[model samples]
Target: MNEIETAPSGEWQDVAARDQLDPDFPLGVEVNGQPIGLYLLGDQVHAIEDVCPHAEALLSQGFVENGVVECPLHGAQFDIATGKCLVEIGERDVRCFPVRVVDGRVSIKIVPV
Candidate 1:
């Protein structure tokens, strides 16, 4: 695990090491006190809000398959790369943060949704 770095709003903050992410699993992290999920798809990484809109469950803890994450609480699914809600139970699309990797560190720029 990597230590999360704090930064001002709208600025990129280091959340984890690039190697810490797994395609089969999502990493849950906090940036600016907001929950975010980090997912790896092929060679790219994506950051999205971790909380499920329908049940407030952590999406990072959900089952991930075919680039979709299913809510552990209510079976809602979301597209990992786009943060779009795939299942009706998801309620609405989640917020996505801009991500970048440098020196094996994963950083994300968080903005208010």
Candidate 2:
């Protein structure tokens, strides 16, 4: 008998249409097996890593209050827009990704700088 293997699909699928994501609630989507936090702030969609750097916690699982994600583990806060760690004093920031919505589709660019 012979077996075949398949490659993983590309990331950034059209998880939600433009009409599905309301301006009031942020939408959470998984791309390439990674949790991506999506928020529509000021006519633009922002995507960030859903994991809190301080601990092994999912930011999406936490509460999204006032443009900041409060880490349910240690109560650390992170700025979703810039992926900046609010609790940490130094330049410890969470990973941020570029997001784009075209033709009523949402996509994420995870290219590192």
| C-alpha RMSD of candidate 2 | 6.5
Clashing pairs in 2: none
Q: Point out where model 1 deviates above 4 Å.
A: 1-3
Task: Highest lDDT: give the candidate number.
Answer: 1
What is the Cα-based lDDT of residue 34 in candidate 2? 63
- The TM-score that candidate 2 achieves is 0.72
**Per-residue lDDT of candidate 2, residues 1-113 (tens digit):** 11112224434445556665544555666666666677776677777877677766777666677778777777878887898888873237888887778998876665634
27-51 per-residue lDDT for model 1 (tens digits): 9998777889999999999999998
Name the top TM-score candidate.
1
What is candidate 1's local distance difference test score? Answer: 0.90
What residue runs in model 2 are displaced by over 4 Å at the alpha carbon?
Answer: 1-13, 22-25, 89-91
- Candidate 2: count of backbone clashes, pairs at least 3 residues apart or interchain: 0
Question: Each model's TM-score?
Answer: 0.94, 0.72
